[model samples]
Target: MTESKADQPDEKARPRRRQARGERRIQQLLDAAASVFCRAGYTSASTNAIAREAGVSPGTLYQFFPNKEAIAVELGERLNRRMLETHGVVFTLENAALPLRELIDAVLDPMIEFNCANPAFLTLLQSSDAPGHFLEEHAALHDSIQDRIGELIGVRNPDLSPERRTHTANMAFALFKAGLGLILGHEGAEREAYVAELKTALYGYLAPVLGTEGVPAQP
Candidate 1:
């Protein structure tokens, strides 16, 4: 006797369940990879180590990511996307009017928090052993951010020529990057102090260009 359709196993439902399980497994693998990368550095981190950390067989890890570089690439892409979103939120019309310190805090605080939470991002980007593609991706992300910064500078100082605005934005980005290093390298009170110093430096440099009245409210 043939079984009713409802009595038979639901093939489509099985696939959907499997896919959900697979996605969860992939996320678990990525999390383990992040921990390994942070501890061992990208060059020294092994797929086997990642698998072991993830409580999965090395074969399982290979099925999802063929190699360590692939894992790093995926993780880097995830981080880059998050940073892009943060930049979008911070560089909006609503934020354009904020004082330089508040504006810088809006941009820098979230970034520092993200980096602190994902140390592997810095490890992969900074490590010489990481894939060249990671560096290229990071460069593109940096360019996008700097371009937005230049636009914001223009908004704040409408009288400044485009060339001057671009120059100031580049300089501000340089200082911000340096501050990031300090923030990541220190902990506790030192990190807080570094952040304060960074804000002071940025405000001092930008205030003159932005004028005493600070960033314009509407632009």
Candidate 2:
């Protein structure tokens, strides 16, 4: 028998609904995997543990991801993409034109926030046991910071040669990463202190090369 027009719409909608639910399930599993990886480390985490963390059965988890490695790789990719998005948002021309202190705040705050919220990302990044391809992907992501920062710096300090700009960007990221580790290691007042100290360090470090704190960049 031919279906009615109204019934056809419902039938077509059914597939979309199923696809949406499937996407949600995939997200759920990935979130669970991230949490497990964060708490247990990549080497110690198992598929069953991730299923438990996700509040799903092992079979349900397996329906989406065949093994723990697949889950870790997918989670790493998602986290990397999110970090790149945050990077893009924070490194705008407006941000680059801010005064030195504000520039440091604008650039570093989101980075620290991203790392804090997604502790699992740090775990995956530091993990030697993660999938090889994922590690290569992450390494490429680290390289993006230099390119982005070099561009931002060049906009402010066009007089500097390309080599100097690259070196400065690398040095800036290194300092920020060092401070980030310290900031993440503390709490409350201590964390705030570390953040203040980081800004101070960056201000001093970049002042000569970039300019004074109160003065905004020309471009």
Candidate 3:
């Protein structure tokens, strides 16, 4: 009778409850880590500081992540995954077919919004002391994004050779990164102004590169 009782639904539920709590704890730590990384940069951020930010003890944080690098690696992976999601929305066929100005608006706004909100993404990406594996992963993420941009360009301007398409995508991404640095350097109205500036710049560049292919009319 005792052995049978051990296999009851209540017993199974206990592990699940514990797992839910563990998951929540992990997320809390990650959120705190983001704040710390953004404020102090990856090289300067400490596990103790992250623990304090999360309202937990240092030991508690250790229970989830072995070290600061582990926390950074996990955070970088999640941020990179979130970035990949942009392809589904902004890089779609419909958006690709929009006018150059509209395409710039549709793509850059949300991308900028994400980077502004999650400044730690840039922190991890630019950190000189970031873990080696994380940097490799970020490199992969960059290539994937470039590939997506190339595909989007091909959709609008199919006449361009593959080399030209790749070259255009690289230039567009480089321009966005440069503009992003300026955009992220400021806050509030200044940042918004930079966003507008970036869109205008992109329009000027893409207008001629994309030509008159499938691009729709702009107002």
Query: In model 3, how large is the Cα lDDT of residue 29?
Result: 96
Tens-digit per-residue lDDT, 14-85, candidate 1: 999999999999899989999999888888899999999999999999889999989988888888888888
Q: Give the CA lDDT, 0 to 100, for residue 87 in model 2.
A: 95
Q: After superposition, how far is residue 36 of candidate 1 from its true place, in Å?
A: 1.4
Q: List the residue pairs that clash in candidate 3.
A: none
- Candidate 3, residues 1-219, lDDT tens digits: the string is 466765667977899999999999999999999999999989999999999999999999999999999999999888888887865577777878876777788888888988988899998988998988888988998998899899988888789999999999999999999999999999999988999898888888888888534565222
Ranking by TM-score: 2, 1, 3
Clashes of 1: 0
Model 1, position 97, has a per-residue lDDT of: 74
Q: Quantify all predictions' global Cα lDDT against the true fold.
A: 0.86, 0.88, 0.88
Which predicted model would earn the best TM-score?
A: 2
In angstroms, how far off is 177's CA in candidate 2? 1.2
Off by over 4 Å in 3: 1-9, 212-219
Point out the higher-scoring one by TM-score: 1 or 2: 2
